[model samples]
Target: MARRQRTPRRTDDNLPSAIDRFDDAVDAAWGRVFRGHPVADRIFYLASEVGDFSVLWLLIAATQGLRSDEDADASIRFSLLILGESLLVNQGIKRLVHRPRPTPTEPRPLHVRSPMTSSFPSGHASSAMAAAHLLSKRSPRLRPAIYLLAGIVATSRVHVQVHHASDVIAGAAIGTAYARLADRCVPGALP
Candidate 1:
């Protein structure tokens, strides 16, 4: 009988190991910084709730679209982008990464909705950042507040112990990239 030929495994494992360590360290640091504060808990919990399915963003869009014709047009366009971003992040990307969430997907004492998606990239973080970007185009005057809200929404995941720090980080980056690309590619996707 002839012996079977063996093939060497591809891709380096050290990089992924190092990344996992970094993510763990950061998540631990985050927990230490803000996990014990009552006020912070309230704020982050509120932000997390608002970030669900990008409801806050949609509300903002509706408000913006209520004014002039131009504002209304821009608002509609951006709102669609926000919804689309959620679908992509929550549905599409979640399937690919398939990373388990920091906590179980079951309802916890926090009373927040437990998401079933994998936790590699946080949909809340992604939608928040993407809406912040697209909505900024609609209302430049509110840019700072918009981005600030986005940051809060993204960090709230970690604060609530629902997602890892690295998941939020990657999600923010992906949201920004997706928004930029969609803004450029979509026909008449103007502010």
Candidate 2:
């Protein structure tokens, strides 16, 4: 019998393929609920917005803040560390996939602007999920707010059409896994 060659799956092939269908449904639902409401649209818009330079500075500040904290800040510091690591992982994946933005050739409208870079595995959604998972684990009371924010961040990518539904889903999974790994490593780091 002749051997059949197995082709390697592209990194993008590993991303969630169901995002288009799922996003359509989600968009339909949101369209019905927030129809013609500028405030609601703006809220959704802001939720998905990522100031690249600002986020980089914030992450740097967060790491510095964590390092400065004493025993009382253990949980917060741990969570930030986990989230930061997850964001790094997400960045790596984005580079590996190197998928183009959802609309590569078209001129994006003002409100729908996004960076002209790779778009598989959204960084914003990844960071938001990492923070939400870590915070939820550390403080039960904050779970609702954390999850709500994560959901909004994930949905925002689709709202602006910067990512397909699959990108956010994969980013969320990666972020969650990184958060769990970080949590496990944190306790061992303490002398």
Candidate 3:
């Protein structure tokens, strides 16, 4: 029997570590750009607000309520399943990791008020990526839009200082995998 080879673990010196530096640079640049901009500040404030996973629940409800044609309804249902799976995987991993959020003492200038939760594998990033992947699979024509939204949402997590770059990357991977799995489990569920 042949054994499967596992990918090596990423170390701090690898390319993945560069994400942290990139995040710091982005934070610094945005901080300087948005300094004293009340509107921008308010937007960040609202962006960071966590509402007990209300967005996921709403997606599920919307899917259930959808009464469109088979293709449309299936797509909606697939999206909802992806959202739920993403949330479950993201939250479950976060609980296990229990990593700490960046401290205010950190040198970066954070635009939004800090979040009060463990910060490994950001839920927002995970959910956004899952939706993006699922949507892109279902509607190839919308790939750009879906991925663009996912990128923005993932970047927002770092902008709000609620998640580290590593967290977002991990979340993206996990969410993408979960969505793929959900799609396999429920065929024709998403157009």
Q: Which candidate is the best by TM-score?
A: 1
lDDT of 3 by residue, 109-178 (tens): 4345455557887877777777777767656876897687567666666666667767877777877887
Which lDDT value does model 2 have at 64? 36
Q: Which stretches of candidate 2 lie over 4 Å from their true place?
A: 1-36, 50-72, 75-83, 104-113, 188-191
The alpha-carbon lDDT assigned to residue 122 of candidate 3 equals 80
Model 1 alpha-carbon miss at residue 129, Å:
1.1
Write one digit per residue (lDDT tens) for candidate 2, span 75-101. Answer: 446545754664575556766888766
Query: What TM-score goes with each of the models?
Result: 0.87, 0.66, 0.65
Worst 10 residues of 3 by lDDT: 49-58
Candidate 1 wrongly placed segments (more than 4 Å): 1-10, 104-109
What are the lDDT figures for the candidates, one per model?
A: 0.83, 0.62, 0.64
Cα distance off (Å), candidate 3, residue 170: 1.2
Question: CA lDDT of 111 in candidate 1?
Answer: 59
Per-candidate clashes, comma-separated: 0, 0, 0
Global lDDT of model 1:
0.83
